[model samples]
Target: MDEAGLIERTKNPATRESLRRDLEGMGIGAGDVVLVHCSLRSLGWVSGGPVAVIQALLDAVGIAGTIAMPAHSAGLTDPANWGQPPVPPAWIEIIRSSMPAYEPATTPTSNMGAVAEIFRTWPKARRSAHPATSMTAWGRQEDEITARHDLGDPLGPTSPSGALYRSNAKILLIGVGFNRCTALHLAEHIRWPDRPSVREGAPILVDGERQWVEFEVPQIMDDDEFLPVGDAALASGVAISGNVALAPCIIAGMPQLVDFAVDHWRAAKHPATPR
Candidate 1:
């Protein structure tokens, strides 16, 4: 079928029903903890956009389960960059005003875009990250863990979003591909800790006050670009066979209980490689 036709099919109620069933078949039920990686555009429109997706996911898991998503915002001038080149004042204000404000708690950190704003409004949530990458979670909060190590760049590499991948942490990634996965870096740190100590201390401007923060972050290899990709076989392989398979599953009129986990590698660009 045509691309448009495929998108329409996946957005239909039939597709939603199938997705629900598929989720259940995959053992995503009550008491399970899942971390979702998503592109709202890829899912198309349901009765409610992201809100509906969150609700549907919650329902499938019932009251005892937990759902998580990544919510990150980058502030180039964040205290860590105090000595760096001055940033555009107006852009900094825009980011500051737009970022969601949450009462710090012991649960997961809340820092993704609109999703962060939505979850932050809920009580009993916390915000955590190394520097640039931020995520929100509920149930078995890791506030203490992140707070102890929230350091480095306020933007770019050292953002505070890397806390989601703590050692032996059980997480579920959804919708988005592996390349976008932010938690896998922690696994890399676990694998290698003595490599130039890339993690550093920085300052964050909060409530008109400069707050110093520290974090452990991955170093950029000579060929590295984009989000850091971990080589852990368990967390670093492609789940989707190709765009062809992903397109149909995302666009099909019904959902099937297929194993859809994947890790997208951020392979280095090599001019010598055959095109």
Candidate 2:
């Protein structure tokens, strides 16, 4: 569908209400901290886009709730010199100047080019436990509903890419599933389900700095094997596959999610999110 059409369907009251019902039934509510993993394309928010979904989630949770999404943006230039590699000169300047200004709400853990303005407004949100493996919000910033554990594997310790749920943590697969879950990586870390595999290194650029960070990509699961399980995982949460292309309303909605996360996660925890 065209972008405008996507926006219209997304803003439809019937679709919105249907989505709200599905989410509420899946244990999303006030007083419950929820870490949402969403695909802006999956929700079909033609009118609202990613921002609308964020607002819908907040309304579901009410004042005493938390919501978060990944704002990671990394740039990789030189492979041989992983950590000390100089940042791409052009990207470096762009990130430092643009990210903070457009969206200044971010912790040190933010990915390349993610605007901090979104998260900075929400002082209390925790970064996701694993930023590299995260699709929404940094690992440390996720709400208490989902807890992350580090496996201690220097190469791929942050995210096991396995299926392991934490206390009170309900996996909201959204439009994607098991392959995308990265839950299996957690299992690989503990050696519970399958054998862990070694992976090659990749590059990424961080905001506000002129250096590149190298990452080791783990072979936790194969795409072919993960397809089926991923589909099953979707049943665990609300699954809406639609298009959303509207720019104005979505821009307005983005801030609400940011505000909700900061207030819920709190600012004191931002520094600790990356580690």
Candidate 3:
């Protein structure tokens, strides 16, 4: 929104203090590990933009808590399978050969959003090394949460998202909804342990050299398909809604949301299938 319109709705510029207060009011407090999926535009003019929003999250969680966000880097993916905007057939090999190795500290995130894109670059932030589905984290368990990420199980139990669930993290969706929620992927992993796989490749440093490695990963479906599950979750009152600096926010426990989604998906996919 324009500056005047944003100020009108927010009553003032969004400041670190204001954002912090809003987050606390929305039930985020000290010692709460949170996985955030946010849209900077939906946040309605944060005073310092994504920077202030990140700070507010840190402040809300305090010194004892941790915060995490998806730091996926699509550019690191195998170029041979680029369908959305596939490259020329002849350029596939060139792109694959020239792509840089995924570096936890230097590689840029694909398109996680302005907030996450910036948060991943925080000086002290730690990131997993999954190349395709890496996650960046801060605070208490930053290392523990993003320590180990296997390419084959990008969203499974060993992935950062899974670690968050095991840690009983809270999911905070800012100006977004279930479509942007990463926690639900954990449900997919649990719900379909033997789900079909897709070929994926990325450049990684192995033996001190950039090698294009390929593997098969559970084919994580589109987010649009998750709408029904999220709608049901909202109807069941699992997702609590509140405001944060003129933006709508959804908060729910990571495990609860994942469990709720898995049950809903199981029932929907197989009506007569026993739980």
Best by lDDT: 3
- Can you write out model 1's per-residue Cα lDDT over 113-189, one digit (the tens) per residue? 34445664345544554334445555443353235334442222233333333222334444444345444443333
Pairs in clash, predicted candidate 3: none
User: For residues 96-122, what per-residue lDDT tens digits would candidate 2 score against the true structure?
Assistant: 334321112333433311222244244
Worst 10 residues of 1 by lDDT: 250-259
> Using alpha carbons, what is the TM-score of model 2?
0.49
lDDT of each: 0.41, 0.37, 0.86
- Model 3, span 1-275: residue lDDT tens: 67677766665678899989999987899999999988887767677889999999999999999999999887788878788898899998898899899988789887898888899989799999999889999999999999899989898998998899999999999889888888888888888787788889998999889999999888776876777788888889888888887788988898999999888877885422112
Off by over 4 Å in 2: 7-19, 68-124, 128-131, 134-164, 191-218, 230-275
Error of 2 at 251 (Å): 27
* Cα displacement (Å) at residue 230, model 1: 8.6
Off by over 4 Å in 3: 1-10, 269-275
lDDT of 3 at 190: 89
> How do all models score by TM-score?
0.55, 0.49, 0.94
Relative to the true structure, candidate 1 reaches a TM of 0.55
C-alpha root-mean-square deviation, candidate 3 = 2.7
Q: Using lDDT as the measure, what is the rank order of every candidate, best first?
A: 3, 1, 2
